[model samples]
Target: MTDIHQDPGAATRQEPGATSRRVIQEFWRLRWVAVAVALVGSFVYWPIIDNFRVSLTHQDIFTGETSPAGLENYRRLTEDPVIGLALWNNLAYAVISVLFQVFGAFLLAAIIEGLGSPRARAFWRAVYFIPSAISTTVTGLLFYFIYQPGMGLMDGVLQGLGLGAWSRVWLGDPDTAIYAIIAMSQWQGFGYAALLFSVAIQKIPAELYDAARMDGAGALRQIWSITLPMTREMTGLMVIITVTGAFQVFNEVMVMTGGGPNNASQVLGTWLYEQGFNQNDMGYAAAIGSLIFAVTMACGLAQLWLNARRRVT
Candidate 1:
């Protein structure tokens, strides 16, 4: 009251010190959390950074000697025909996984969600998801037996059904090896995707479906109009996860065909493993690992961007 015409300069002069003190207090409060995050980040990222650095140097696996090779490892990777084959296989695997793992799972989830009884839904979900619970190595070995030439379960079924002519060496043929692995992968993985989609589907409001039904929408129409649109985010997520997993396929190839039949089923993951462990080309393997990391990150980022853009629109 006495200083009704207070100086604007006085308020301005006090503002900076107040802001500085506030910032200092906030930092003090969060100092331990910041320190912990930094420590964890350093621990987690040091190996990745070291791998990138190692990719630039030639390292003797037996003697533990390393020499600067610059981009020679990347050059070798570019020129290698097996690398090209592995890249193509990875692409094909990703496409198949997107189709079956993501889309197929959506269909399965819809079917399960449509069940009249809760017990029936639960039973079918468990049945479908049981295969995913089995170890990947065991699944690979089991499929290896099923795809064995002339005497496996698949061939036996073909014979029993009077389709013996259709039978062949599923995992041993150059033409069918990768496809067989893809099929096995789908059988093992699609259920997990289905379970995820089912959960997402459940989160969608029942009122939406009721409204659609009131509007005389049939089952298929309701699914197309309401279910699919509602699960768009989940579908995008599944695509990202499936594509990433497909590109990193290894355990199945290792256990089923060992990237065999003249490397017909080779994927980047198995190729990297072979280069590092078997061939002892640590630098080349590191380069391949770096490439994989780059590709996977790019794909995931692109997917996220597209989804965000869709939402914004």
Candidate 2:
């Protein structure tokens, strides 16, 4: 019998090589993730940080001079009456959008989904969604012409229906300008919202409805007990999106009323544009942008919290 012995240090020497290979593999794996993080930090997070920095200082466009303004811009935001009007206008947009786009669209979707004929359901969906597919600029311009005081179709129809006394310059009058713009937005937006609600409704199990029916549930009962609860997530999402979009509204107001008739139709987005580009107040504009960011972020955090709560429960 012959005794064979292996060098004990050989195993220890190979362990270091194995460890080195693992370290290299892990480095390679994380290299791609590092690239993504770097890109996002540069494009997304850096801009946000830079915007805050810019908000603290005033920049002159023509003179190309930059000066620190501290909180003066934000102080002006508190005193600026136009800012108050813009906030009110955005609030109206959010409230009306929630009413029509969220609740109303959900009802519309339920009704459309309830129809027996597939063709009818498809037809109605297409009709409603058509307006959403149209360009906002084109839609704004189209509504602008339609809202013209004397020559527009709206006034003409009022006159033809013997309701001429009820007609006002839809886009010209300060009292009605923002509302008119809001109405146009609702008309263009509700269809898309309805389509989303319809998709959510479709995802619901038919067995739930069948079970409800067997339990003596009517259409309204089924909707209340089954549909509403099932689509709660979708409804929450729509509310957040609608409110955010309302605050960010710019194009339609810009194209239709130009925030005119005394800036009655100005929303946060348009107000920011007016401050930065038109009025040449970059610092003030940055502050408005920060406010918008805060609001949208709050909505996003609310959504996250709701989702977490739902999961926990």
Candidate 3:
């Protein structure tokens, strides 16, 4: 019988070599991603985690002291009447922004893109986009002046049209303050959204529109059948962004009214600022921030899930 002898050293040596190869392969695969992972952890994830930690503790900014507060800050958020008002304002802001910035902008973009002349299309696109290119602070200040009681442009136009009685102190009154800010927001922001929708519309193949036209489809019919469906992804993305922006609105409100007229225009962002910097309630501010984070995170996750569902379906 032939003697079979196992080389134990050979087996051991081969095993080590195989394991080393796997280790090297893993390191090579992750080499490029390591820096991105580290940066994201350091900047985004770490700040979020630290914010949550801060939300659970009360801090005296002047004295540089912090103490555990548990869920007290969150509980306080529930009891605060301003919080409820701010949430309602934010919801209104979201609803109005979606209507104008997302859907309205889509329609405007379709119309602009459908223009017979390329120069006309380009001119109109530039005109609409000018407001968005302007700084938000500058727009806010401009609108602030326009909303002035008697001297503003709105009042002048109303007076010119014999509708002077309709004009009021747009930014000073509690009943009209938030809506005024919302209007300014729509004016400044719809242009940007329309620009985005215009790009999306441009990506649609001309052949699709030609096919629709050959089937006796008019402009509106073609838009409904071809454009809307083609731009659904952009519409969905715009809705998410608009809603997030509505909730996070601060600049216009701060510049125009500072959440004034009895805090009537206070959104969560302004309210958080009011609590943190103005009132020196850092813990409560962090809690408010947490709520904002929760809302924006939900919006982002919902969009992701919708996209995934669409892909699966």
Q: Indicate which candidate wins on lDDT.
A: 3
For every model shown, what is its TM-score relative to the native structure? 0.93, 0.88, 0.92
Worst 10 residues of 3 by lDDT: 304-313
> By the lDDT metric, which is better: model 2 or model 3?
3
Deviation from native of the Cα of residue 19 in model 2, angstroms: 10
Better of 1 and 2 by TM-score: 1
Clashing pairs in 2: none
TM-score between candidate 2 and the true structure: 0.88
lDDT by residue for model 1 (131-229), tens? 999998999889988988887899999999999999988998999999999999999998899999999999988999999899999999988988898
Off by over 4 Å in 2: 1-28, 307-313
Count of backbone clashes for each model? 0, 0, 0
Candidate 3 per-residue lDDT over residues 162-203, each given as its tens digit: 999899889988899999999998999999999999999999
Model 1 CA deviation exceeding 4 Å by range: 1-3, 15-20, 29-40
> lDDT values of the candidates?
0.90, 0.90, 0.92
